[model samples]
Target: MLRFDPKGPRKNDLSSWRPDVVQIWSIGEFRANWATASDTRVGYTAGGAIAFLDVTDGTLLRSSIIESNSAATGGGILCEGSSPHIVGCEIARNGAGFGAGIRSEGGAPLIQDCSIVSNQGVVYSAEGAGGGIASGSGGLVVSRCIIADNYGADTGGGIFLWPESRAHIVQCLITGNDTCWCGTFGSGGGIMCHSDFATITNSTIADNSACISGDGIEISGSPTITNCVVWNRIYVRRGNPRITYTLTKHPRSGEGNIVADPRFRGGGDYRLQALECGGPGISPAIDAGHPGVEDADLSCDWGLGGSRSDMGAFGGDGAGIRCNPCIQVFGIPEMVEYGDVLNPVILATNLGTFDALVAVVTGPIDTTIPLYRGPPIDVAPGDSVVLERELRIVPSIPAGLYRCDVDATLRGEFVSRGVFETILQDD
Candidate 1:
């Protein structure tokens, strides 16, 4: 049995490194960074965290565990018949033959609020499967996770569900996963279900790639897809998976289905920030969800008050502590003449649930202009504040565009940032 401390050392501490043993612990966290298991033993070997040898059972909560570069099955965690419940954990950068991050063979596990990223599934016997997670028989339930940057040698870059596996994936962002092995013969970049039953709902699958087919998802049996935004192709070769009320590039005859870009905040970041602001390049899938669907994810909050459910992984009222602020620049002339007062005003808003103090700065100061600091303004939730500063445009100044920016901080930590563009005209 093993024990952990909440305020203990980092995850890479020597106390948290457990090799191949059936370790048991209470509610605590274990972080494993740059851990290694050099044993070449096969069959559900956990190089990073724990390896359930026989019929062992345990539960883990609020833990960050990982295993790196293993020659066996599970690099991060391996479970045979032990039912382990993992919550709010981060499993990353593990490598194995079967399941790089996690391998569940003979037990049912519940994984929620976890970030499984940058894992790999190498080829040992014949083919590599399940870069992020590989489930053999016992079903699993995953919710509200960020699974990204995983790779597989054969199939199932993000997740591989083998035959007779029953898994339910809800409200997860699956992106930047790939399977490009043996001259592009791999498939199922995001998920590959070669099983009988799999249910995926309220998830976003985008920017995943495979060599031959099924860039987003590939299934051989019937699966249920609801309220999801799949930016790539869903290759179904066998059973007809009833997909409805979702946003995809190819929409069949269904209720409230559309084909449009989800308008992600950035590449690899599948969050719908454009919908919250309602501007150009906004995703049409916002507020276009089925009311009959229920949100089962217990990690993050979504959507706005008194609005319909969102189509993708995020839905409901956009609440909580947000460090992303909205910034706008004002009183900047396109063409400025020499010997004129260059007045620039920057407006910044705090959209989060905390109060922040904002600071503004201008660069490319050619002349010594007298500047004064303004008093700190207290910004509440969903509030905006303006910062005014004056600069004198002298004759011996450079005639180019000047850059202005604002930064917000909470408790002396930088949280949000805004930038402004100003032009200096030639005399």
Candidate 2:
């Protein structure tokens, strides 16, 4: 029950905004045209419920809850020209002409700890998308959220990643959603991730029905679906042979996942029940995952608490081993730019037993150092080993911060890889 008072940002009223403060969105129907008015903008908003075209400065929507809200364009709350921080919010039953639940048509939204469900699009035709949230060229950070049970006419049942949008969905749940196509264009029933750099980590993306293709999840850009459990039928188009080539024939650099029937608990089970509870079997997928997770996130749920590692989030409570190596560079900023050479002594401590040949791979760049045996790289019992290798940065690397990995590949078995990101600098 939100009240969008008949108020407008008129008569030089934009001067009553602070850029550094946290804007509280207690009501909905929120809209802002900050792209046309820059200086008078808020930064963050998170707290109560809201509705309407909530026009304002920039905002950070954190810990806010929006229920049964609506807007002319952004059903619940439209993030058009203003930069907002939408953190810890509950956006449900909202509707937009374009972005049903949460729409970032012009600005970026750093969303976290939110639940987007049961939202719809007013003009939901075939070519539309994002039943939960949609962003174009916007940097989105969606973590620890649940995006489910939403309705989109075209595509993206739980969530959608369209062109030029960069998103990192970590520790999230995308399940039991529907994508119904009432018009002509239909794709990515569960999630249509095309032409974007997205990372799906430690998440459950299961039981999503799509009207077009990409039942559970689909990716076209440099997408890495690691430590995730994806279940749903791979859709096939009527006359498009491109779907087959885009999924199976794409040379991808990602692994450690389950494509089998992760038989969940029940037909209505969005919780992703384990195999013992009618889920994925004891295949090689168990205990097989990309070892690039943080130490704190290691204690996540692994469903049945089995040994080794399941190929998704929920690492079970028994996950005690932290694989990623800790780098201590005694040099410039605790971080470095994407392309900056360094002669620091690299250390590859063997947290595991036996012997290991640690490889110091390059930055976020695709080039790998190699698979070779170091000077008896061994840490007996409970100890650590250090290697003094001169590291060099590549110029073709990404601009922002970058990560360097240290891994062990014994006889090409692919043991573990520890990752560390470098600080990014501007030219």
Candidate 3:
């Protein structure tokens, strides 16, 4: 049980350096440089617990575990010249003035099986580099980790790779990330690479979205992308597949890949499947890519079963995002229109480990059930419920907001009552 704040800095009278626990409360901006300032030998395991602390240390840092902050700029961390590592940490609500959640500067991070989500970047600025992890100038690696739900005003919602940097991602997932004002400046919903090199094997970057440029995997520098599944890319450069080049050691043929939809079993807890609207198919990512970098991956799987080198993240065979637990089910409309269905769209997300089969019913009969005959049912872990009823514009149907209650069921267990509201429109 921990608490946090993004308004300012943590308490001045900090606690003694605990090798097991460190919960900081960062209101605005505060620094947590973890290098022993003097000659000491305290083996503080990097994955203990660091909750609620934000600041711009050296350049690159990782305030992992039990840690929480709404920091911007070199967000949750900025890997300066050292290897600021964070294991089993949580970075939520934080954004970047420049580089959000994480600014992976020059070094080799030891991030194993962690979660980085919700962090974001604002406006169009080079400052907010990576909404999740900004990789730059060196050997930065992320393995068996999940980086999702982050936001970026410009490029790299999940990761922004600067020039001259390199990454070795394995069995990881980067999805559901979004860019500000879609289709504007700074693209790449999942990853935005300018002039660098990265080898993403057995990883997943799906359902990620952007406005103008690359949606799944955006590459500019001569990168070696092998056996990875890239699906739902908005507007990719047709016939200009140089960005997604393959990994050729000898005659490096720029970028390379299978450019196909691996057809994941379940995208994740969100249950949002891939729908091929104007572009490619659901799986089979249209172009099998050039024959040159075919042998790049050891997993051979294009978008079907697992092979040697994977397509995108999970080698075309991996689990997607699970249901969110800490989601609050409530709503309050800002505007309403005629015929425009009026009802409460209470989205109760379960971010906890277990499923929250919560039931949110109406208080009185003020608002009708099944608004507009739409789908208004129960939502699971990472699900949503929308209740609406058609409007007939009766002789005199007042136009105002109505209220409701929010209840919950944790594994058939019911909780107290909560409150929410909605609005009604007239003809």
Candidate 4:
């Protein structure tokens, strides 16, 4: 864990941090005021006096920022005048007027794999925005992150966007944010957008509350929302927010939009699952996303490997796809004659946080051979699946290097694909 004392005895600058020459590191904790004596002073300004860390440029990776306090802006970290990259960081329990967790003022910032939670925004004199994060005219992009349980006094309990700014949020979970102090004008318990352009895709917004309205989101300008699951309400005060391919609790009219429960797992776990396996399963949301839609910020493949994106934060991995399954295919035949049968063996091991569903292997070599239809084979956590399936070769099949493209749909629609090579020799 690399700790940076912003108010070091010698200096208060980060000149010693060289992003280019430093080796790639994953810091566990990045406490700024761990060694400094607590100051009871009242006017602790932007980014806090001792706990603030201004990341004007470069990249921050795999770090957690906690217990920061600021009376002005950005309680934990401030990104101003320069672009920076933040990945896999936790910004929590911070307090500020504008942004309790992070403030992107004049430059773009890329935030991914992070959690901004339990932050507080106080509206003393000026209007408080963004309990978790605030973005100014400079655009920002957020992906694969969880922004939850933040509280704001005025607007945007989760995130706020300044006028003319732009933001792209993908595959994120925004939930449990509350805007309490704005008596009749509180907006966007999850997000408030006053920007010209904004886009939210393949994300989930749930359980947010506002004192006035717009419990899920409030938009002043036109924005595009696609393939998202909104469990609450939304308010568009000015321009229209074009929504498409979404599942919402209240019926919203748009292309491919449906009023259906996204079936997120309860008890504080919001991951989507299938109905057959219990819990409010998102059977309707799987493979129901916008076709050809891809989240550029997502590092891994989404859905059943068909280039189709899922609706919510969990994507199309189905119920138990969150459990990373270690699957291996072997014993593929090198050569086979027409009218011959080929047997392939598949071994799968579950190595993730939850139990994986039954393994079903389907293979139709080039859509010519009949597919092997099978039943669900449950693979418990830390257990393995030893599967053997047979494929019959038709005499009408041509001679060539035929590849058996195998697809395993675990749980429900969570698909894992593999290829087995075999040469079809003419007999």
lDDT of 3 by residue, 226-300 (tens): 444445463333222233422221232344543332545552731112343222224453233333222222222
lDDT of 1 by residue, 346-373 (tens): 4444534223534354545632222223
Give the per-residue lDDT digits (tens) of candidate 2, residues 3-66.
2222444323335444444345533343322111221122222111232224233354455556
- Per-residue lDDT tens digits for candidate 4, residues 1-427, read 1222323322244456653331233545545432222321223355542222333333444454555555477766666543455666788887778887777765445666689999888884576779998887554667678999998789999999887555667678999998878386567999998865567767899999998889999889867787888998978889877788898888777888888877666788776665444644344776677764532222233453234666877673222233355454443445667777544444444532222323232333345332334444454453333344456778766787765554555444655544556677876
Which residue segments of model 3 deviate by more than 4 Å? 1-68, 124-126, 234-260, 267-312, 315-427
Ordered from best to worst lDDT, the candidate numbers read 1, 4, 2, 3
Clashing pairs in 4: 358-377
What RMSD does each model have against the real structure?
21.7, 12.8, 22.1, 15.8
- The number of clashing residue pairs in each candidate reads 8, 51, 70, 1
Predictions in order: lDDT: 0.64, 0.50, 0.46, 0.63
Count clashing residue pairs in model 4.
1
Could you give me the TM-score of model 1 versus the true structure?
0.63
